[model samples]
Target: MRMNPTFIVMMKCSEEAGVQNPVFQRLYICLGALKKGWKEGCRRILGLDGCFIKGFHTGQLLTAIGVDPNNQMYLVAYALVESECKDTWC
Candidate 1:
């Protein structure tokens, strides 16, 4: 299978930015899809929430956002928060 240049570039960029592996490839795809879909239509959101993983203590942090309309999933955004503020997740 052919490798994606964006992943390669993102991995290198992440390393340079001091971010660890298992990086933001999925979120990147979601963002790219959203960008493409914007020309088609705008996505509406009903409710959004974030979930935690990797136990209470870990190397990196994660938060998930979902963009939905009429119970249909459209887009998602994930953030790696490095702060203690659980409410202020991206």
Candidate 2:
């Protein structure tokens, strides 16, 4: 048996104003390896939704979940935004 190397595919974050606020207005997650795997095993259709977060910062979680052949849900991509406005969706 053989094992592949471990590494970080994607990692990113955006801050609000100067370092003072340090709050992230938006956050995204998309793993390069997962994307490639999805293309090979997942369906073409993707389900998306947004929900409010009750934490201190208070925001919306936008996500795209992939529906596999077995009707299972797999995370494809996601984002945390300050709001769920039209501009943000676009």
Index of the highest-lDDT prediction: 2
Residue 51's lDDT within candidate 2 is: 93
The number of residue pairs in model 2 that clash at the backbone is 0
- The reply for model 1, stretches above 4 Å from the true place, is 1-30, 56-70, 83-90
* lDDT per residue (tens digit) for residues 1-90 in model 1: 144332211111124455556333222123555444533554543334445446654323343334444445554434444333643332
**On a 0 to 1 TM-score scale, where does candidate 1 land against the true structure?**
0.36
Q: What value of lDDT does candidate 2 attain over all alpha carbons?
A: 0.71
TM-score of each: 0.36, 0.70
lDDT per residue as tens, model 2, 1-90: 124333223323456566654544677676656666677889988889899999667988888888777989978888877788775654
Model 1, residue 10: distance off in Å is: 8.9
Backbone clashes in model 1, listed as residue pairs:
none
What is the Å distance of residue 27 in model 2 from its true position? 0.6
